[model samples]
Target chain A: MTAILKMKGLGFSYGSRVVLNGLSLAVEEGEMMGLVGANGAGKTTLLRLVSGVLKPREGRVELAGVDLPGLRPRDRARLVAVVPQSPSAPQGFTALELVLMGRNPHLGLLQWEGPRDLEACRRAMELTLTWDLASRPLSSLSGGERQRVFIARALAQEGRLLLLDEPTAHLDIGYQPAILDMIEEIRKETRITVLAAMHDLTLAAQYCHRIAILHEGAIYALGKPGDVLTPENVSAAFGASVHIGEHPVYHTPVVLPLGRRGDDG
Target chain B: MGLARNRRPPREAVHPSPGARLLSLPYLSSHLAVALLALVVIVIVAGGIGSVYIPPLDMLKIVADKAPLLSLEHTWPESWDTIIWQIRFPRVILAVLVGGALAISGATYQGLFRNPIADPYLIGVASGAGLGATLLLVTELPIYSHGLSLLPIAAFAGGLLAVSIAYSIARQSGGLPLTTLILAGVAISSLASAAISLLIIRSDPDVRPVLAWLLGGFGGTQWRDVQIVLPYLVPGVVIMIAYSRILNLFQVDEDEARQLGVNVERTKLILIGAASLTTAAAVSVSGLIGFVGLIAPHAVRLIWRHDHRVLLPLSMMVGAGFLVLSDLVARTIVSPSELPVGVVTAFCGGPFFLYLLRRRGRVTL
Candidate 1:
């Protein structure tokens, strides 16, 4: 399959500190690529670069063969949608209002949302099981509810590529798989590409078709979950010795971290 | 788990289309009608009352006579015509225009900065205008001609220059940080205030007129003053109202707005520029009125939804009506000796502001 998102020699820095250096990755059409990395390992920065929120210091990002930096924001948004980690939802806006904003990328500056736009928003909300919270203020929703609402918004954008930063970071155990499953269903239905930064290695292994392990500021390993998420790779990248086992049903890798020196509580 | 178990039936599913409930035409029209009626009543009643109290019927007749199509009998004395048409009429209209301009600009500022305390004058317009007016007064420029004064022109230039300076200082890496913007504004405002004080101290002993102007009043207003301000105020206000939808997007952080296809930096600059124009125009004509900008938007938010499409226009009306009523009190409460309209707004706005803080407990920007 052709790559929907291509990052060539991506480099970024925060003042003097380099976060991503010569980082290259590609997400193929209609595939879910999981990004696994240790804390401060530039996962969020990579997603930001892909979403065109931050300009790369060097190299380029291409969305469907077009240079992302050269495109206007509205045009770029039409090709890519992003769900940031723990996005701050402004108070007094209803869940429906927030979701309808997803249509903004598609609408003109002076255009209000029409019937088709509202229909798409409603469908996205229903798919995420957030239609009941449509009239509720964002401030009133729980963290999980807010995350689902944001995910619904990204879905409403109808972009060819979706970028999510720690989408399940704040979800409960019950919701973690549910939200991921909803994304998987959406990908199947729409044939869209997804690049999600996942902290849960086992969950990533279960949901993502392929996994890329990031260490420091480079890709440590990239391939199928079984090939990339080996015990040695997880230990080396995360500084945690982990026992890797297979899932009983799906037969995918399941990571269990071992306790470090002298800490048994 | 609890969320799924206690799920309420989807309200959106019941409606044929989404946003129908929130965008109900009947609800919006009813509220609009009530506000429009209140505004009309206040304009008529306030026009009737002054140092010389003309009855509401006589005020209506005076207005009717002025209308080209309506040839009403001129039973009322000719002085009533001058008072109602030439003097009081223009003053009331000025109050409405200035008040509407200030309030809508305030709403725009608050939405752009995402801060409840952000007022139109937050970025040095008041002090800069004051300094400009004071300079013109002290120098005694012979530029006043045909009911047009050079003071307002100087004030407008000063206000725009001050805001531009603050904007440039606060902008970094093509982003405007709110804290930095506020700090820059405060610094510039203090510097302008110092200049105004110095000018006042060095000027001749006859500074009462300048002092009174600084205090802010609708006194001595004529059709000419209204005409002078309309060119700036009307366009600035229209631009702000046009961008109300974009302003709603700004309530979120800049990155979020940009991701939603809003040109965040460009929109911010345009909004700030438009708001500054309105503020400078209003202040130049009426001399530094306080609280209308800050209070009117807050009042509208308390009653109506925070959607800027509705909030902007409603706040304008509220501001216009509020100042008209306040000007009425300023002229009559003491009777024969008028108070500056700004003093009354502050007196009323202060308590209302405090009440808001106490009631809400915490501010949501």
Candidate 2:
């Protein structure tokens, strides 16, 4: 399969602090990959770079094998869909309007949302089970509902590659499974590639086809979740020792962190 | 075309849920109808009201009779014709255009900065124009060459220059940070204000006229002044109206705007440029008219929802009507001598502004 998104030596920095250094990653067509990293680990920064929201200091991000920075906005958008953690929706926007925005990449100059765009938006919202609340303001929705609305927007983009930064960051447990399950189902239905940064290791391990653990802005481990979600790697990345056990139902690796001195609660 | 065709098959075959369908639809036709009604009302009331207080029927007849070219001149008394044609009509037209321009530009600025407080004059545009006009006054330049129209051009140039500087500085990176723009605007505005002060204080004489200009006035606008403003004002208004669709997208999120193939930076530059031109032209002709640009859009948003499609045009009509009504009062309130149009607008605008502040509660920097 052709690589839809390819990053070469991607590096970013703020002031003197280097966030991503010579980070090389590739997302091929129809792959669902989860990016697991601790706080401040540059996962969000990587997403921003791929989305062309931030210019890379050193390195290149290519879409459909073409160089990213040089491609026109329309072309880049046609190739990639991004859910930036939680993007701001200004006042007066409904769940439907927000979703319709995903179709913007496909629109022509002077062409806004036509019936076709609306249809795509409708499909995305329906797929996410958020069609019922389409007319409602985004602010009125719960965290889970808002997250699904954003995902629907991404689905509407019709892009080959999807990049999400901590999509379930602030959601409750019930919401986390429901939202992530919807994403898993959408991937199966559409064959759209997804790269989501997940804070919850067990959830990431369960939903994602493959896991890539990012430690201090570099890929620490890359493989199946069973191989990558070891107590040693988790401890090294988070500075806390933890016990890893298979989830009873899902059979995914679940981490239970001990105290800083390695004592159980 | 290829992309559109490619998208049609899967999208149509795959039915979207009814809930999603409701969200994506654009209600332009209905919005356009409502906006048109509001505009008609604004025009009629604006033309009809003044100290002379012409009735709507007579006002219509007076207007129909005097409209040039087609010459629909209704058979009205000469005094009424003079009142409608020469005085109230022209002033009302100017007020509508100027108010519309300022408020539209204000809407543009607010979207550009993503802040409610961000008016078109947020960057030193207003102060820069004030400074330029003040300089022209203190220097006692050959006014016979250009007449009053020179002030608007000078102000336009100053406003354009200041905003360009602020925009460039704020967008050091490819993106413009909202906080940076606000800070830069404040910094530039203060600089312009200080320069205007120095010119006022150090001038040999003519300081009072300069002060009056700073306070804003629309005392003696003639057809000549209207002609001077039309070239910039008309094109500027058209550009702003055209950009309203993009402004709607921009208000959502810059990244979202960019993804939809919007060249966010370029779109923003065009908007800011157009807004600055309108403001400079409006300020030049009318003097330093305050609050209409800020108040009109906010009022529209409060009454209606915050959709730029409606907000931009309504704000324009509201602004124009507002200034015209205020200008009418400015003339009739004291009669004979007449108050400066700016003073009346400020009086009205000041209270509205306070009400907004009180209602919204205080926003800390």
True contacts kept of each: 0.37, 0.39
lDDT (10s digit) by residue, model 1, range B1-365: 55444344455454433443434446657887888888888898999898788998888787777788889878888888788888888999999999999999999999988898888899998888888888888885865867567878988888888988998999999488877988999999999999988888898988877787788998888898899899998889888988887788787778877887788778888888899999999999898889999999999999998988788988999999999999999988998889999999999999999999998899875
TM-score of each: 0.94, 0.89
lDDT per residue, candidate 2, B224-309, as tens digits? 76777788888888888777767777866787777655788888778777888888888877778888888889988898657676
Model 1, residue B355: C-alpha shift (Å) = 1.1
Q: Report lDDT (CA) for all predictions.
A: 0.86, 0.77
What DockQ would you assign to candidate 2? 0.31
Q: Best TM-score goes to which candidate?
A: 1
Off by over 4 Å in 2: A261-265, B1-58, B66-74, B77-83, B146-149, B204-206, B358-365
The per-prediction tally of clashing pairs is 0, 3
RMSD in order of candidates: 2.5, 5.2
